[model samples]
Target: MSEQSVRRPTQKSRLARYLIPIGSMAAALSLIAIIYLGYDLAKGRISPCEAVFQESSIGLKTKISFLKTEGELEIGREQLAELTERAQMTALNLKTCCTVLDAGRVDPEQFLQCKGSARSYEARLDDIAALVRTAVKEGMSTGSVATTAATAAPTPPAHVEEQIAQEVEAAKAVSRDFNKQVVQVRKEQALETLQATPPQNVTIGAQEREPNSDLLTTNGLSLDTWVTAAIGDGKDSDYFVFTTPKTYRDRIRVELQNRSTTLEPRLRLYDASKASLGDRYNTTTGADLSYDFVAAPDTTYIVRASNYYGESAGVYLLRVTPTKAYDAYEPNDDILTAKPIELGSDLAAGIMDGHDQDHYRVETGDAEAQLLVTLTNSSTSLRPQIRLFDASKASLGEQHNTTGGGDSSYLFKAAPNTAYYIQVRDYYGDAAGTYTLTVNEAQPGG
Candidate 1:
């Protein structure tokens, strides 16, 4: 070999050596970039997990509030069952959310915290469902078997509602706190994940016969049984038909009850001739609306219900039954035909209408006795008022407006052979119930 050939081989070897090192360096840099890119992509997965966790958290809150309200109202068995189904569905979704959140692996400790919190929320919901079922069972066992009350359950106490509300608030707080932690962990991983999506307003799902979606007609419902329904949004109304089978000689009594803190129920009655019965009942918050009147035989009666404010919605339980004929003598609303009660005698009467009043006449027979008049509610929630009047219907003294589970009493000196009238009316003109009136002569300081 010559000197030129050897020089060429040496140059080729140098070039090959330099290119090999350069190519290896380039490959190493590419691998590092790819690894960094893939890590960023893995962190990006937290965004969707955050979204799901947040959504499920809010949904759980709404369901808890709804359950509390249902329990407070002592809703019927069917409504309770519907609420149970909703809770179970929400629990299932929460479990899915837990799995997704865990897969994100943002922070192992926080992921575990969130999972445990989600499980706690689901367990609380299950407890609420169980409570509703127990309540329904107890109500069924103790309810009146008679067709009059129509197996309608009694209203639960105020404390029961308060307890339910407290429990729901606690569970809601847990869910809220867990969601906050999730967001915090997500932020630690990627600050952009902190931008939580706007939450949607939650509303209860509409039932089959939603008042706004479908009209409840006589064709769907009958009398003498309890029916449960909801008053949904936007001018919702419920209609029920009651037909007196000619054999019904007494009046038909209809009742509407609910525990909606938001809805004020209003009810009206109509006859087969499309004539208004002029029977109307409107109640305030936490009150029931009822109508009792003599319906004609072989006549079709229409009962319509709606929220008085036209803006609220809730579930309501209704029932219709035949009631005994009212014995209140007509035209005796005033002092004209006032029923006379002897001294030391007791009389039972009721205010059957919204604007109704009862009057009684008493004469102190030639004896300067100590007169004690008392009015008591006959196991009812009606707040009553008592007024004393002279024979000329002039007010003798201030009106008596004592209320609550106690009786209204007026004690005064009785003159000899003087006739006075006692007037009984509902305080606020919104209460109606049976009450007992007693006139007694208390011994002088004995």
Candidate 2:
């Protein structure tokens, strides 16, 4: 196996002369050359192209490694699930964002600038969406592999971890930028498409059907907080939550400030399954809708909003007061936080990145170290128990997580930007502590 010398013909010297998008090929050609050079150096032979291809192939096959983890978390089916879910989320979300801008609400200016931080705004959500799609495709493949390992023969693949590590590393680096680029492109021009006339109604031997329900629906919920017809309408107070878990009787109220205005807005919510619950509000101006939960909780439902759609002119609040307990966190769980934690003044907007909300970025490296956090004690007496749950959905057989009198220590892994939940168990004859947790990855995982 020798690395072939890379022989990329220059774009300007292409045999076929056709205009093209330069940035589109920039990262790819560069990646190919870098990969080729590395391959040749590694094999000490001259077929770099083959080496690069081999590396790519190996990366694909690495997901869902059948080997046992020496200890700690994982490189298993869960990772794939997470990746796929991310992909779907990104895809759907990106389409929604693009649709909004096309509809004439969001400004295109965010993407025109070039700073990474600048790109961090709504402009880069497309990149995250793309990344999610890639992750999902790979995740499905990973699931298949895991299933095969679970039932088929016991032959093991070599260095699956290393292969996967390389892929994950590469994936993280580009996903955000990809999403950002999409936004940037949008910013440079108006969605000229929005100006196009709506489709002609060719009645197909059918009575006019109910105006197709706006594609957005809150089946997962029945009631939600309506801040106003438009968000940020000079008045900032608007919010709500799921009144009853699994009970989809939405109790929250929304008062649209500009229902008379032709604004189509989107409302997003999350059920216990971590599924997205959304509704598109096409305006005649605006009307209020209440969302109720449809299922019981092994989890908590979360809510947030976006205005790529027209109704974005006003504030819509989705507010919920927990009549039910904040059971998502148990009394004894140790929680990790987001480093460069997104600073939000209040829970109304927990945190948002250029790509999404409720999620923040962090860096990780090769070894697990103590995690960074700030904790607050809530109960007068429940001491917290920190437990380690692995990707297999299996609790590590031997490692008992740290137990705390009130608060506690150390992050548990080295998977760069790897996410893990801290299990806080109700403990030692004490009331639970409501702690504020923050995590900073001293190094990003590879």
Candidate 3:
């Protein structure tokens, strides 16, 4: 349109043109701003705490993935699976905490909880890393050994092989040291957690009752309970006494968990007569002490806890538990201490360890009797073996099963009024298990 014919452009038209474009531009800027704010908020940028938590959660997830891949290749499958499960659980917890914080919930308790979870996750990662490192180093050493053994034509010099062995040993030592450090850190963390929150399902006993340095004034402890106490100073000792259960044979475990960084725990066990049964001490700093024994029925036992160096003063937790119930006859590991068994009796017992041997004494009547002794394996790993011995501790005959979880029998003529011994053990001294030994008169002309 011609300017003259249309006359000068109206101010309204000019304003309309500029305002329409400006309005459109303003709307576009608003939309962009909204998207930016939403993205920033979603990424947990609302607060410093939320930001830190979000960062931590992402970092933990990444670390866990790496650990899972590395652990599967290096560590045992079961161990790796367990670690992975724990890591996943921890990651879920961290993510939940981060979400809560991101939602602008300012709860001090929740914040503390998240902090604790973070610490736990870090500790777990450290432990997994240590395990993987150890496994990798061990694998390397094994591969080196195999290579050295297989190389024949291009054999390395003796000194070179020796040097390789030395290097492998050094690597092992480093791995061991790293593992120890990780163990110490975990122990310290566990102690802290325990102190912060006492365990459930446990009767919290009293603190150290002074003058518990002797049997007469010792503190009494209960089974499946925790006792929190402290050592005052050098030469300070804490004594606890408990009665064994009335069960025929009880496996008792005494544990001492150190609570202070400066304290190294030492545990000593004793009987009712104040005779020292045994002792255990922590070999590393911040390690726990544990001692186990098979106690006689309805007997009193004493446990003494003291600092390893008898110097540093700190807090500790002591607990006693009956771990297992053994058969009526135990401590009969040799012919001299053989338990007496009656004829036509079947007895159940266990080989407590690979090196354990059970002995039983059988007495014959006034007439010659043919005895049929049968040993039946009760554990899948045990290959039963039976040995007959005269009263003079001389072996008469022996029979054993060729395979595990099998039975063995022996037939012999018993003299009148004579004491004979029956010994039982694992065919190979490497498996521990339970078995039943039966003694009966053999049928004649059947």
Candidate 4:
């Protein structure tokens, strides 16, 4: 081979050597860039607000984990668990918001929604952090264990435990207040958006009638109809009356939309006797109000709307809708209205609200017989109970299911032609749902 040829081959070898390392370095740099970009995306690079919220959430979770590890802490396990669950939920919501924001194609409404969610998460995380800090501080102060030569676990002092409980309750109350504020913020934002563009396909049935400030001169409102109204001045209030359908009991939902920027709406409900059932109002300016109740059949209910501060005056929209229909045996919530149930017949009914009670009357023929009253709970949250009363409203006996959504039966001897009243309700009086009640005569000598 000639010297020129050998020299050309050596030069080519050097060039190949240089290109190999250069290619490898470029590849390595590309990999590093990819890893960095993945991390940046994951950390919410598109939304600095979301990034800050996420960091705060992570810090809160860390504090909660630290609290959970303190086995000797006097904090209630349930409270800690609740705090953890709430923290997890906050984190999940933040993550969702971040994802939406990072998508880069979100519309204005979606962006606003995500921003609102982030704000809510931030507030909730702060509340949770405060709660955790309280628990940690209380635990540190009261969690001292007595030790001897041999290891021993000692109970906290009674006073210390009581103090911790009180502090925990107070912290929980603070958290609840924060949660309410968050909800109010979301509601206000929603109302602003909704008022900007009213929902489609909603029928405006009637307008407010004047001289309707009091219940006596109230305007008549049809069920499931929207009414447009306005508060002329601070003291002005609109009263609308509607009677529940006589066919069946129903769950009535009342919604008030504040159409003006200056108005804070307040809503109140009254029964036929002018007794207040409940009231809902917007604490935030320009926010809407909503309330729901189980209305008995053929009952007249009055709705009153006014400015929340009684100062701001503006136009508003009101609508009353019946959301759910209950069983035919409704309006039998007391001894005076107990529905009659025949032997071997099963009737379905519902406990529409926490305070609702259903009463049924059973009469036996002209013979002494053993009566079996069975109540089967249909909702997972309902622990059904049956109470027996004589015709004179004297209590005879009661039976209730220990487990939720279980069955209960009461057996008693019924004299001929005697009337017994059966009252059904949730055992705890804090749950609502449906159940089936059966009245049957026991077989003789079986």
Relative to the true structure, candidate 2 reaches a TM of 0.20
TM-score of 3: 0.38
Judged by TM-score relative to the true structure, which candidate is superior, 1 or 3?
3
lDDT of 2 at 118: 25
Q: Give the per-residue lDDT of model 1 (tens digit) for 189-299.
A: 544332443312122222224332222233234566777766776388776665775643355778877857766787777776556676554657656888877554567
Name the best candidate (by lDDT).
4
TM-score of 4: 0.44
Tens-place lDDT per residue, model 3, 1-446, is: 78775755686689889999999999999998997678568766455545555566556666667666665554446645554555444545455544444432544555465556556556656655665556556656556766578863233344444443443344334334444443454455556655766322222375666777755567888888888988888788888888888744566889888887777788998888889988988756667788988666689888888888887778888899988756668768778879999999889888866677889999999999999998888888888889999989999999998687888899999999999999999888888788888999999963
C-alpha root-mean-square deviation, candidate 3: 20.2
- Can you tell me which runs of candidate 4 are displaced by over 4 Å? 1-205, 211-223, 232-236, 241-250, 258-263, 270-277, 283-288, 295-302, 309-314, 321-324, 363-369, 390-394, 401-406, 415-419, 427-431, 441-446
Judging by TM-score against the true structure, name the best candidate.
4
The TM-scores, one per candidate, come to 0.33, 0.20, 0.38, 0.44
Tens digits of per-residue lDDT for model 4, 152-252 = 44454565566656655655554454445445545665566556653222222578867787756678888878788999999999888888877556788
Residue lDDT tens for model 2, 291-370:
33333323445444434442345433344332332332221212322122331211111101111112123344455655
Off by over 4 Å in 3: 1-204, 328-348, 353-371, 376-408, 413-433, 436-446
Better candidate by TM-score, 3 or 4: 4
How are the candidates ranked when ordered by TM-score, highest leading?
4, 3, 1, 2
